[model samples]
Target: MTGRRLTSLLAYVTTAATGASLLTGCGVLPGATGGSREPVTVMTWAPDQTRATNMPGMPAMAQAYARWVNSQGGLDGHELRVITCNEQNTSAGAADCARRAVRENAVAVVGSYSQNGRAFMAPLEAAGIPYIGGYGISEDEFTSPLSYPVNGGQASLIAGHGMQLAESCRKVSLVRPDTIAGDKLPGLLNSGLRKASHRSAIDIPALEDAAEYSQQADRARTKAGREDGCVTAVLGERTQTFFDSFRRLPTGAADGDAKGEEGGKDGKEPAVRISSVLGSVGQPVIDRTGGAHSPFEGAYVTGWYPEAADKSWAPMRKVIQEHAFADNRVDPADAGVQTTWIAYTVLKEVVEGLDQDTITAAKISHALDRGARIDTGGLTPTLRWKYEDLLGAPGFPRIVNHEVTFQVVRQGRLVAQKPGFVDVGETVLSAP
Candidate 1:
């Protein structure tokens, strides 16, 4: 479809998808639920494939959290049973996961990642199971009243990149997939850049699943690193491959090298910087590339939460070490895994707040919908979702958290560049 047509379709979907939760009647509550002793069942899912952007660790993390929680005699005396699912990164698979959650009568779906929003969301919404802490890949996560997103998803990432680059870049280049979802990148990125009085980035669309992006990388590097230029890639898992190709090409004495427009009087040049969002670049990617020696060593990364190395994550790390020692499925630093941990934190708090009330999908959604404040141990500001929390951003009314953290890779670790959340709420709500 043409760009105009795709844009039009996205706009329509945003409108039709708008609305709060349906408050569907009770489907099935857990066995002996609210007895102050029954297990509170929940579902966690992600794509776990050898050849895709698999996040087997997400569900595994949920399992680990369950083990840790139950070992402590459960949350508020309620046993936690977490069911895992592999969405296979397909629409049909995502739908199946949702159906299983409904059939299993889960109280909530936590911290799962999937691009097939339409396939999965409708079933859960119909069943009244609140989707807490999704990775925000699909717009539906924000549009659906059932979805309680802990992060701003891609919308904030792209806009935050523009905000980050606007400060130092004379020009910017964005390398993205040549797909419908990707077509939204330029507009979102430009929203922040234009806000800063900077020119829009040059959009560079490339083959999503190609073997190598050498040509595209060359173009991006030449355009972005020319002087005070910057290039940021957001091609999901393929972003690493693009940058690998980007590294192999000799890009003019490296960035910040002498002889460029940003050259210091002492013969040191201020070359363009490279950047990406959380999923594409993280601790795992850095370690795989070469740690301090990795090409991403100096790269800027925007993320939904605090850095993995932050002291705030020590509790989560300790949980994984204590309970998930034998499980390679969970990575302590993977955003998918971290999100699962936070989602469970929210679940634990809400469940405990129930006091003696029976726990059901409807009850859970109602508590969150009516404004239940969840504290994430400084990982995020207190989270509450009332109508006032909504961003009113077209198609994404439920984005209560438009704040993204700026992170940088240092010596193989993801660390905070700025120690607090940067609000991109206006940037996103104002996007073209």
Candidate 2:
């Protein structure tokens, strides 16, 4: 072969081996292109190998979704190309990811996870890129005009968690990260409690990346009282650690001798029930901590979406089984992964609605703004982004889905405590 042909062959072999495209900051899926349609590129970013909360599954799921869509002759005859980045759980890293998306000319940033929303949102907004289906950890996800969040963000989860606890918990203690974002949780929780005439939860701020939360756990236990009291932590990855410390307390000796994974028979020892949101405590966490014998056996978990076992997730599971079976990082049960799936669903629908030969970030945003109805196959309410459809809640006016599901860990599985979604738009509006 000639020199030019040999060099091109070498580049092709290297690209196939690494699964990266020649396009800057992109990893095009194998066989993602079809027909004569132009490929629509998007980006997904989440923290990995971080001291704080990491959502490696979010980006992994995005790639898997792209593969599945492309396998089915692409989305509306247009190839779906997904570029992933590690946000590193820092402001600088988030800004870098957004800049990369801009540099790569990504039409949208879909189904991504990042706590530093402000850092990322500015760049995407400046580039006129629409952000879809964020994991809802940051305030900017709800407040930014360019951000089309699929969920109500952390604001709804904490508020809905307070409502879920109000039904059974006589006294509630909340242990959260001692950061600016954490400062808003207490008031949101209290607002939901007031709906049931319940008193405010005792706010206990703790380090988000602490190795162990023994001191905060002890304080939470003390503040929660003995009977019908509940302790809820929203410390992301450290939530499991906090619960571990909570269960190892001297007061838990009464239930120590229990055999098998069915440990929490009549609820936790010392009678303080544990609780948390879906992102902090999930099926993966429960399975890791001993399934049915987990410290969260009877824990109350508030979630933006339905339980993983719900039939609504059948499509997502199918995609994962086919495209991401070898990739262990993509867990269908993970909230971050689930959010990415929903976000991409929105992207596909919005793109199809445009029905244009050329797709652009401005066009996608305009299509969403003009009320492109997105049905997430029952995972969430039919999503629409019209100006009138927004919840208009304080600090989260762009929130369209104020519904949350109340879930419980039973026999190593997270199941719905109540059927259907509970609308917390009113509670969120009442928050300080």
Candidate 3:
């Protein structure tokens, strides 16, 4: 089919998909319901069933949030309508989702995930629909004037990851995807390492969805010094595969484990420590691999939010338990789910503060751009989109919350290594 035909067909499918929600008390019914405020419609898209990183949970969480909020008479009396799409992890797919959002007259694209930032952002920009609370994997999420990011994106996480490993690892090897987004990882990471006067890491680029990484693993292991060295992989879903290959190596066993702090079993060559960012590795991955016996046991993790077990997540946990009890996709521990929850939180704040009879894309963006402050119930520092609040970092000027948390896997559970958030705004600014 031609591009226009494909877009038209996608719009039809997207609209049709939401029809089932009406029976579940979560569908959009144009105009006011029972004299309540006008309903606010939004879209949430993420890659599902993809070869690369798939975040079905992000859209799932958005739907769950809509159900929960609508159950409570909606957000400040305005019924919340959520339209979900599967971006399919392709540029065309991402663009399709954005075009559907426009066709559906969505006020904003909230709590969505997509690596094809350029593909999606253009359509949203042309429609004047604000891109809110995107999973910050692509640089476009940080640069688009219409995009309002809830987290500091990969730039903060990688930079913070570098800082997290600086004092511990003697040498670092970064195994990242060889893509436009992946190209920036080294500079961001190096900036953080340089703060501690540590040397630059060995940059090893690999396919994002490679079936195995024995070669890259071997190279990373060799580059990491024999003793007190670390290898950090940020290859999304393939991170597990990389580590699986990594451990099969003669020295991969007990990697990042304290048993090898001094040296390997032979007490001569130490196993390299392993690490990754939140999306690449999380509680779900650990639980699946074998909790308490998982390969991630002693691995370092950097994230944009507090640990999943933190008390701050109680509200989100409650929503998931009550409204999303049967939805296994909405894992409270998953960062995508957490981001969606936070994104909806921002939306709620924006909607309630408006107190308007009807909400629109222009109105939502105007409220945010005019210095609307959002309190995520302590999930993140107060988020505002004012020009003065930005980081002014090269290629990422929209980063306002440049804070990251340091986490470590202890007994197969990710826990905070250091209390409180670490400010990486300066580190992002100093990147090459």
Could you tally the backbone clashes for each prediction? 4, 0, 0
lDDT of 1 by residue, 16-90 (tens): 655211211121123323343556889999988735477888999998998888777677767777898999988
lDDT of 3 at 186: 96
Query: Model 2 clash tally?
Result: 0
lDDT tens per residue, model 2, 38-134? 7798999999999999899998999899888987756676778899999998999999999999999999999998889889999999999999999
Clashing residue pairs, candidate 3? none
Model 3 worst lDDT run, 10 consecutive residues: 254-263
* Candidate 3: stretches off by over 4 Å: 1-33, 252-270
TM for candidate 2 is 0.90
Error of 3 at 105 (Å): 0.5
Pairs with steric clashes in candidate 2? none
List residue ranges in candidate 1 displaced over 4 A. Answer: 1-36, 250-270
My TM-score estimates for the predictions, one after another, are 0.86, 0.90, 0.90
Report the candidate with higher lDDT, 1 versus 2.
2
Instruction: Identify the runs in model 2 with alpha carbons over 4 angstroms from their true place.
Output: 1-34, 252-270
